[model samples]
Target: MTRTTALVIAVAMTFTAACGGGDDAAPETTAAPAASPTTAAAEPDDATDDAVTDDAVSDEGTNDDPANGATDEVAGDDPPTEEPAGDDSSTDDSPVADPEPADGFSWRAPADGEPILIGMVNTEGVPGLDFPEMRTDLDRAVAYLNDHGGLGGRPIVMEHCRAAGSPDSSQECAQSLTGKGVDMVLLGLDIFPGYTTFSAAGVPVFGALPILRSDYSADAQFVTGGNLTTMGVIAAIAVEHIGAQSVGIVSADNIGANTSETDLTNALTAAGIDYVSIKGGDNETDAGFQALIREAAAGDPDLLVSLYSDAGCIGAMRGRALLGIDTPAISTAICAGSDVLDVVGDDAAGWMFVGVGESDDSMASIEFEAMLDDGSGDGASGAGLGALAVTMIGTLARVANMLAADGVAVDGDAIAAVMASGDAPGSFPNGETIHCGVVAAFPSVCGFSLPVGYYTDDGDVATLPGFDSVSAIDYLP
Candidate 1:
């Protein structure tokens, strides 16, 4: 399954868990079929296998009621209530406060004000790669932002357009959004290499995750670091935290995957760690996956890394478990989804991922949960793999705050100016500040820092210690 599908499944599973009263039942154990050592040595080469397609690695990129469309407004519109100083009793005429949750995040309602339109372009309707959940999350985030004092007290109006995973379609969507006179644009994970459409139209574009190479360098686009930068962080963690002397990498045999592998190899070599890499088809068979893992394990490397798609991740985990290999493993956050957990079961317990921030406990995470509680974002029982929705919400809030603080009119030109002036607002979920154009090659990557985390059998994540510094690894192209 693709990451997008994994997210949909995860949201559905979250609802199931919630309906089941958050039970902590353990997954049933099953005996996996053992693989022979000869099977590993006789694995077919990926270079000549046409059957192994790159569907899983293709970057085509959940959901509450599953039926409630993005048009529905979130609940609560009252301002945040303040407690009386040194007094417990409330006045008979005083307005009643909203009940606080056990997690301690105070909820507030969207402010009443003029609407500011923000455009969004996402890939949807393409076979095996639609992301309607992203639009839904954006809608929920806008509603929440409006309740909590939206852009200078102006409510946000979202104008959305869908692309069919093609450059022409992406360009058309950009035009459609611009025609609506949107103040700015938010991009979802699109493989379409047409960011220039937005830049040429003079609209400032930002996204939770960057997928294409153009997205990393476009002057008008900004994104939280995508797979490339995340790989660098992973390399740093392997050498620093895991104390890995040697690393083995398995990635899809695609252009994007190739670029990621090269960057990761550079980072590892720079850190003085020896490494070996193998490429496999994006939709590798179970035997293909086993061969890749066995080859990596044969080296007795301290760390085994998987940069494949969601399904590939599942294949790797299963392969590892079947072989009874216990070498510590790490992968991108794409692997930490519900589908993978459901498939791999206990095998996912110690699999670590490079993430943007600490999970569940960070200030940003607390705010993210509060927004979800107020009927914003996906409203899943737990924050899933990517945290894309949370990243989008936090990024937009910072942009809105920057505009508010400067008394600048909310418009494409003004927003672009604010971003270019290097006065971008707010830190990442990990409390790391973002300065656009920090790296000359990847100019649009606003934040370079990342946190590490491992998965729990319950589909939750536990944070690990690693490189949190943008300067820890060099990311020059």
Candidate 2:
């Protein structure tokens, strides 16, 4: 199932527990869900707490449900005490394994092949902002790679580190991954401030999502979009396609969102488009969003742009709908989430946004769909071409393709060398090409262009004709 579907299932299952109002007793303690094998280094208990919170507020609202008075009737209900001799019941009572694929979607690696170890760092355990799904996606991609001719016939193995949205946790993960002799590091939507650690150790780091200043300029770090290029594309679309000569921005009050605002401002000014920017809380309330939207629209902007998180996006859309404003609207990819769309309903239709990959019928997209169908990657989450599944699978596929082309053994040093040689593969999952070190301000940004798409009345995103390349836009120093 898609990530959206999975989230819906989770929400349905817990809706009663979240919204039930009659109970007044303490809730029962349940076993935490198991972390995916790829997240081997994560603290299970800590991660589980965040996961539960994410599920509880998947739609970002509070319910008046009193604590359920449920308790374990049999406190010591562990497994049976008796052992079943040679054929132990506990050991042998395994579920049936999934049937092997009957088509080409099967593992092709030699059984005894050497393993190619790739390190991954992701953010998790931060309440309401964890991304266990990122690690899960990478794990699924590695499994798919191993099944479809592992990197140069070597099985791909991922060693993961959980940053948990803290500098210390990030550093610890970097240090641990470096010490493990990993070939390269994949930064999966991490807010870690420790890319320097990997760079100092001469390890090349590839970013699935570039969310920090270091992500743009760090030596040996290459990312899908450098320094808000994706936002730049959104700005371009606002001016070019939407006929928006004057634009207003509702930006999240965060470092990354501020950077995006600056980038977009530069692009809009260069294009001779008039623009005004206003800041809002990343998790603004409905009233706060209405006021911000009204204030921004008061200037008679031709278009409204939301550079906030999904929550802020929902608020902005609701605010606009309430005011009956019809100005063309656009948002960052994060704002186009399934939850946001569901909340906004028909109001989301005709809104434009930027994405990293194409939704077209390219061979890559076809293969990606097949992988998802075969359960090879985490279902879609995130926005644009760099959705969780796309980024994980695309980044790894590029790496594997590069190694296979050179007939080189997959090793850390060799991979780093290739990345630094200025000839590393740059094809994204959406069939876009990126060249690292091409921009002075964003030296490590690979893909500097983004695809534009509009939401339909049915809440589906439809890609426009072509992508917007903002390479000429000046970058902030």
Instruction: Judging by lDDT against the true structure, name the best candidate.
Output: 1
Task: Please provide TM-scores, in order, for all candidate models, with all chains considered together.
Answer: 0.74, 0.71
lDDT of 1: 0.53
Residue 382 Cα positional deviation in candidate 2, in Å, after optimal superposition: 6.2
lDDT of 1 by residue, 1-477 (tens): 112221111111100000000111212332111111000000111121132222221121112343322422333332224432223345687666533111112242354566766777766665544666566655545555666666555666666667666666666777776666767787754555356666677677776655655666765444356555566666767756677789988877776577667767878877788999988886888899999999987889888888775688789888887888877787765565555666777777557655522333333444444444434444442334223554555555666555755677665566556555666654423444456676777777666655554554445544443233333336334
**lDDT string, candidate 2, 170-194, tens digits:** 7877888878887777776556546
- Please report the candidate that would top TM-score against the real structure: 1
Q: Please report, in order, the local distance difference test score of every candidate based on alpha carbons.
A: 0.53, 0.51
RMSD of 2: 15.4
Clashes of each: 3, 6
Clashing pairs in 1: 109-147, 110-146, 110-147
Hey, what RMSD does candidate 1 come out at? 9.3
* Candidate 2 steric clashes: 6
Q: lDDT for model 2, on a 0 to 1 scale? A: 0.51
